[model samples]
Target: MVRYIETVLVPYTDKVKEELDLPIRQQSIAIFDVFRAHRCQEVLDALSKARIQHVFVPAGCTGELQPMDLSVNGELKAAMKNEFMNWYADMVAEDLKDSSTINKVDLRLSVLKPLHAKWLSKVFHDFEVKERHYLARDTGSSAIHQDRGINIEPHVFELYIDLMCQFKPNEVLNYIKMNEGYRLEQTLQICRKYKLSEATAFLLEKAGDIQGAFGIILQKLQAKLKLFVDVMQGGNTDKDLNVLFLEIDTLAIVIIQLCQRNSGKMDEASREALWFPLLETVMTPQRKLKDIDNKDVLDDFNKLTHHILNSMMGYIALPAILQKIMQDPAYNTGKFGEVRELILGMLETYNYEQTLMKTCKNLLNHDIHVHLKSLTSAAVRGYIPRGDNCNLCNKLFINQNETDSVVVFRCGHSYHLPCLRSVGSVHVMDGEEMWACYLCSHSKRGRIQSTRFHRSLSNPNQAALQQTKEKSKEMTLDSQHIQAIDAVRKAMKTPSRMAILTELSRSDTRSVRGSSGIFHQENFQLRLAPPIAPTNS
Candidate 1:
């Protein structure tokens, strides 16, 4: 190869240089893959003497840098090997025709052997007619700028914005929007450094200074007026996801309106007439549209939305609507004002339910605490054990005259333990002995008798008796049980589950408001869905 380059390639290049009237480059380029022979000292010296500059292609970069070399040489080697195999097969078949046994066919061993040869890859050279310039390096900042962005440090973002803002005007907002890791205050200061009113206002609004954002827009950008509208409005073509946030916000407001109507405390007929129809109007159309960012359909979509809300206005009275809106727990008189009433109202309503439950629990606990305190205080100074006589036996023979009776009632009655027990007046109540006056305990005696009868009777007496000795016993709910029942009824009144289900059911669909029209796929509209380009590549 060194001899071939010195003898053939050098003379050919000299002849071309002498004959051609072209200003050619003095240096020659030798290109090839990583071959052992090409890297030898003798070959390098020969190429150096011939002034042929070498370009060795990297191991895997042959496809790109030396594309033609691999295609021609690799295919040629494969084709030669295939032809040799065909020739050898033919030779073997001819030999078998002359032999008797096919299995032990006679074949030529020397001349018919498959051709085999070694190939040391030669360097590729193409003579240039003129001098050429090449770009070896490039700083691809443009490509880097077109990224989703990384979670970089706040200081780094600030520094980048500060440095790049001058070079690229309005670059600060783009960078800040890309990277969420930046501190608001740091970015704000950086924006202030360049006096970037737009960027400053954006940061301010993100920091919850809506008024300042507005002020900046009005005072400076108002002349050219570019509002910080969301990316949802900025040519976002995602038919579902792009408009998802907007759909949710709209549905939230709509559901809050439904809840508002539900909150009116109206009569059943009024609610059925007004609320359900309004609900139907809102829901029926919303069932058609969930999230749509297509620019073409959006105008019609907005009109449809307006029409639904307009139709709803017919059912709900203005005064009733105003009253319900004001009643929402988040009905603010200041700041965002009534706007917050609907969206935040959902949270407020749930919070109010929790508050009601907590209040009920607290009230119940307080009542029991007060009752217990009263019982304790009363017991502390309760009537001295009635030493007069036993209320049941009218006998205080043993202890009532000197000491206290075996048990004393809050009603100031006394009794011996045995007498009260025998009469079923005194009982072990809450691990303590208790008794009541015979007259005071008259109504309660039936309860004890009924209990005694309950313990004595078998399961056969499960049925209620027609004629009972006890004063016409009837079933009744306890006060606590009644309160609990009321709580459950109140909870049942909240249609939150239904509202959430309705919210989830919202789909990117299209339909007429009334039952006159049937549901159909929106893709059937040709203009909305252009013919998908064929994937030829």
Candidate 2:
């Protein structure tokens, strides 16, 4: 180092000082990285003899502390990128010009090594040193001269894409995901055109277009172009692949959510109607289906139809899955084909139906027994007939005439014997006439009318949708809602409660029942206060 400095530094400093004749410092300043070799005694002695005062830059702060480190960045990188691109193009062109030898991996590597070597070589054979500053500025050895304008690497995006095409795609995908400098739209378009679905999915998800990414993955799976595991792989497992794994999970969930949201927009009928065709499409083995594993043809139409009807989704409707598809787990999802949706729909529907059935069972076991016992007890104990008129025909009871005497229910409702016979509501129970009051049945629960069960046969889904909307509108609970509830509580206590039940408006009965649900833990918890046991007298 001493011999090199004596040979290079002394001559350069002396020539600049003597010839340039500019404002000169007493001693030159030298900067070096904080390394032992660069700050050794020998180096200090050499610097002192050369009249150069040395400053050692702190570790990892060279960019801030050293002028050369700062100057070397930005512009130099862009120039290197441009040089690499130019070298690549020249190599390809030269290969084309030569005899048609395939540009193998070794050939490409040889071309790349030479280009890198050229960049690393510091012997600048061509140097333009201006002895005089154009502006007549006094000279400093490291004074600003070159403008060092921003280096523009022409077509860097395209060049980078070409590199991706030539190199390991997994590494390139990692770069594309992390680098914010990419023009995302252009990158996305190129990825699509190249059929790089994996990269395209990552870009789409990163851009917050998760639906698009999901569709891309599904398409790849549906087309049998890639397996789910293959699509999920962001890179080799030896690296951090958590982000990629999470991305696949998110994509799978998109379909499930879409299934739920879209299904919600339609009613039961529309859901059922739309489902059959989709199911049929899945069942109809395509000409391509036979190609897979060399399966037999599905030409027997009757057998196919029977198969459809008996399939898991078909039997229950999965008795019915349009609901199950929405809740299906996405992690186990691997492939997409005609049957995946069909099978999932069936299973999901079965699950939903199973849930509903179980709920109904729970409701029956816990809720209905109390009501049945109460009704039986009410019938046995009996209530007085207070009304003077027949509840059914609205005619005054003829107490003096046997033919038209009012037939009174022990439960307070009165109907003319002729009206009762006409409706055939009367039945012999325990050697006495018995009948269910139309009003009582209604207040107890909604009537089991065909209209209630069938909804609108002509347009059930639309009818259900409208019903759902109407139902949703009534969900608000305000003071009036509270007051109406309070009125029901007051009615249950009134001496005229059961008798006036038939007279209560439909709105009142519905309002009373609305706050009341079968699932209430305290459904029949009516009493003035806690019961007190009586002592035997």
Candidate 3:
């Protein structure tokens, strides 16, 4: 089965992918049964190689969840059974007429004839129709209604909204706004009945009842904070603590939005009462970092801190809260200053991390600089070799003395330097000076540029480039660094290199240092350079 999938199914999928002009990973999905055959490593490997995400139906629920099992397969089985029964009846009738026993050879022939003629064509036609129906249903209700039913029940829509509200309240709110039939009052009633405070608050706000929405949000926030206090004061499971933190963050967002909308109407006293406890939940350290052994719990705490800081930054009544804090005698001490600095530092670090993540994603999705760099490195290292002849001129490199004139790129294509330079001059005239390997350059037409790289180049001081040059001069390229770069260049050929790069990029320097000292003691010293101050002209 695995071999069939690899040899046949994947190739067919590739053909379809080409016809559709889709990228390698095109959100292709495959549903598989929970049979042991589908669960085998070989089958999974084939699916992954084809870039098809394989999802398994729950065991014993294939009939309900699997469309083929529900429709096409059932039809095919019934058609085959009917054909066999007809053949059996015909054979029995002939036997009764001849008054002789039904011959095994005749029975086999009867079964084989219908299987090829009647059953095969019937099953094929049925499968095609049923498969189309199944696909239409899977696509959406509009497609399903076009084929099956024009009108659906009101209760079905209600059930769907209820389910969506539980999982995705924001989506349900959007749906209610777009759909005229979906009444806000009815949805709000359902939300309140189900205790979906988030959805209820959203609906109330949409109804222009901002104060009501604020009240609901505030009530939920207080309840969640009280739960968090209880959990912290008493011994609670990590799961409970995590839930409390998430709830607190979610409620904080609602409160922030409400406060922003009613900023003029809301009084300072009400704002203080509403925001103080929420701010304290974040500003006051719930527990010492050393006391939390679980990494997940620590991460949750950081996430909650980020959420609280973001909410405060967005909150319209921030000035009121700051005034309240300043006027309080307890905050007059040095502790308030320390807490304020800590909050600012956390926010800065969080913003920096988010920016880094966005930059990395942009690079991965669009930048070709990394590929160009790899090509350049391969060219410098003489990794690209001539395959018995110069690729540009289509002539054999017979002269051993002229071999030094040959230039090979990292892509293993070689050409005479003069031939490459002639072509490169044309590219340079077109505003692209850095010539890439023929194969790599022609694979994509875009120039390699990154935001960070461009920013560094455009800087007045060129600080990043200066820093790089200084580092290079301080620690000249060693054999280890060359070998490591080579290894990375080689690994870039594999699909997994992207994931490896992402992981490496995200890793903290301390963790990397603990794992391996890439910088040796004899060659390098660990010293912190004093921060450079920007000069005013």
Best by lDDT: 3
Measured against the true structure, the TM-scores of the candidates, in listed sequence, are 0.22, 0.26, 0.30
lDDT of 1 by residue, 413-487 (tens): 676555455455556878996655655666565644422122212223332342254334433434543454344
For model 2, residues 1-537, the per-residue Cα lDDT tens digits are 777678987778877887778445557777888888877899789989788888889998977877776765544565677777776677777888886874843346676787677864421211111211221133122336544333334357446665665554555566565444457788887677777877887788678665566567555433431232343233335533345433433543443333333445555665554444433333333423434332222233223433443442332344344344344453124322434544555456667789999999999987788888888887788456878776654545654533555566656888766555544466799999776665566557765321111121234455457556556333334454345444444434322344334435456555555665322325344456868999899
* Candidate order, lDDT descending: 3, 2, 1
Give the number of the best model, judged by TM-score: 3
Off by over 4 Å in 1: 1-156, 162-186, 189-202, 205-537
Considering TM-score, which of the candidate structures 1 and 3 is the better prediction for this target? 3
User: Residue pairs in steric clash, candidate 3?
Assistant: none
**In candidate 3, what residue range of length 10 has the lowest lDDT sum?**
449-458
Which residue pairs in candidate 2 collide? Answer: 313-318, 316-319, 316-320, 317-320, 318-350, 321-349, 324-348, 383-410
Question: Could you tell me which residue pairs clash in candidate 1?
Answer: 288-509
| Candidate with the larger TM-score of 2 and 3 | 3
